[model samples]
Target: MAVAETQGIEPVDLAAGSEIDEYILDDGVFKGGMSTLRTATNSVDKKVMIKFFVQETSYQRELSSLYSLQKAESRNVISLIDYFEAEEEDEWFPQSVIVLELGTVSLQHWAHGKRPVSEVYLKSILLDILGGLESMYTAGLVHCDLKPGNIMQFTCPGREQGIWKLIDFDCACKYSAI
Candidate 1:
């Protein structure tokens, strides 16, 4: 990842040992964004990944989309395990509580800018993304942002390797309720 001069000091640190918010995440080559604190747990162990926000202006819309996605695409989308409003330790703290998820790594991390992702990996990712999009589509939702960082890789309870999972729905579609 290429990181440049930080205009503002990062308020949080998002690594394995502790949680943080308002930190600079310069990991993605496609985008530089904010890294927030999050926690994840599988059947065996719990881990954390610095959650990045590619779009901060629409955090509310994205968060709402996530709730809807979670209910319908639970099987395919990376789960947002927890979220809550943040309390100001100081008077200047940000108001929104951060969204958390179960998986942190993505397909790009696997491919490392290499295109023509292997047929097997490509097929697996497509299927999982389709499953997630189908659920959203059925709900009249659209995933406006379908890029590398948003698509994470994870091994669910019964799935094998290459079981790609979708995450980061800040640009997800909106559907009328039934």
Candidate 2:
């Protein structure tokens, strides 16, 4: 399938828009320790996952981590699309949104189902994930939160399928050079 296509899944009504204030929030698809993951459709109906932070500090941490990852330029790392902030009526006043490339299912979901993976396939994924971590370390960044839920599995054919992506860098921190 094309990158922009989502099979038969219709674009959700996120009250979506291009700007920060113009965009709308929809129900979260996944909830993490510091953020809730929601689907936001663009003006062109393209779907992107948005990470809404529960606190301003968490947002800052994630934003900084993503910036570091962007500088690392690792193919095994998840890509950052865009980010924005929207006003909230609740205690979380200004909600920070981190836009990202959408993935089908997380490794956590797969593991939860107790699905058996071929040894070769498991090794391939581990190697790819380690490569990403190596790149982060080389760039002086440490991924503090490395788990299945934070890892995205891409099913694209050929080379794309070879490397799974590491995500959820909110807890990632910069370490002093050794």
Candidate 3:
């Protein structure tokens, strides 16, 4: 794996098999506006998704939002497993990393090239999204960047259908009552 020099901060291009601490990157990197995501596994080999924020502001925002949501413990929202800063001296590595529950698929990818769903199924998906929004609102935060790509589909062990949950929160902010 390529390491960044300490002279100046550089963007690290992570590849499959790259290990960051105990988590190992297992798939291709998915780049977003504020961060990059990768499918990884923890020390015990359980699958997880890791997010590396590009900017300090974005990292702090998402970390705060996740911490608040963690207290709320909403089933409609994605769960944060662990978080930490890279200990490596390489400036190319992202300063902040967040480990999250891996989803079966992103809503955007799940919807692509698929047939239209029943009204009940569509309503279920909408209701799940609404539930997530309600949880965020109740937690005094607003997800400013709601989109299909930010929604994840997960399937529980005993459930037949998938459950949709809100994921990204870098664009989220707190709200105060009037």
Best by lDDT: 3
Candidate 2's C-alpha runs over 4 A off are 1-28, 86-93, 113-115, 157-162
lDDT for each residue of candidate 2 in 69-95, tens digit (9 for 90 to 100): 788888778888888764555332346
Global lDDT of model 1? 0.56
lDDT of 3 by residue, 55-95 (tens): 87888899899889888888889999988775466555646
Write down the lDDT of every candidate, Cα atoms only. Answer: 0.56, 0.70, 0.82
**Whole-model lDDT for model 2 versus the true structure?**
0.70
User: What ranking of all candidate models by TM-score puts the best one first?
Assistant: 3, 2, 1
Candidate 1 structure, TM-score to reference: 0.64
* Cα shift from native, residue 1, model 3 (Å): 11
Model 2 clash pairs?
none
TM-score of each: 0.64, 0.75, 0.87
Q: Considering TM-score, which of the candidate structures 2 and 3 is the better prediction for this target?
A: 3
Window of ten residues with lowest summed lDDT in model 1? 1-10
